[model samples]
Target: MLGEPSYTMNDLFAQLGLDSSDEAIDAFIEENKLSKDEKLVEADVWSEKQCMFLQEEWKKDAAWAIVIDELNVRMHPTA
Candidate 1:
């Protein structure tokens, strides 16, 4: 039986319409990192498209929500 995954960082990149290459993913992670001083939902860093995708997935609260939420935390690992 299939189950929801704890998506890898590359999986997140692909899902988020980004280059899934290791270098690109690494660069994206480095570039989009929220400071230990900032928060994810409050940050204004995401592009319009990125924000839309995240908001839609979050509203659905379905298949991608867990993965998306995980990605959210990874993107903002602070208060």
Candidate 2:
């Protein structure tokens, strides 16, 4: 039997209304990276709606927060 569905980078992308494919996710991360001082929700790469979602999920430590934090780390490689 299958356990709970796991949330991953692809899931997070889909939640944000982005291309959720592996290739698209890789290309997007490569193309849009955050500087050491930049916050994930404040980055120019996200739309206002996307930013709000991220911020709310993170603040609430919701189920999506884990994947969201992972994305933040990946986006801030310089940090």
Candidate 3:
């Protein structure tokens, strides 16, 4: 039988650019009060929220960039 994928604190810390020390990771986990069994559930929800926020922000920024580029091109047509 195959086992489930597992990640260490170091792997997560490196991915998040956080301190790799046990104390730092432990404090983060405790502050969030994440139980071992519920960790995946909480992380999934958090990931979804972050993805939504980024999508909205990216849409806004892209719209602004397009508008700015159009205005610049109109102001300097031969550039």
lDDT of 2 by residue, 6-79 (tens): 68999999989999999999999899998999998999999999999999989988778899999999999897
Per-prediction TM-score: 0.62, 0.90, 0.35
Worst 10 residues of 3 by lDDT: 68-77
Between prediction 1 and prediction 3, the one with superior lDDT is 1
Which one wins on lDDT? Answer: 2
Question: Which 10-residue window of candidate 1 scores lowest in summed lDDT?
Answer: 1-10
**Candidate 3's residue-wise lDDT over 1-79, tens digit each?**
1463444545545544567687876565455443334423234424665435434534565433343233223333244
Candidate 2 segments whose C-alpha is farther than 4 A from its true place: 1-5
Model 2 lowest lDDT segment of ten: 1-10
Model 1 ranges off by over 4 Å: 1-8, 35-43
Q: Candidate 2 — what's its lDDT?
A: 0.91
Alpha carbon lDDT of each predicted model: 0.70, 0.91, 0.44
Tens digits of per-residue lDDT for model 1 on 13-75?
A: 687688989898667666787877764545686678877777786788866677777766776
Looking at model 3, the pairs that clash are none
Question: Ranking by TM-score, best first?
Answer: 2, 1, 3
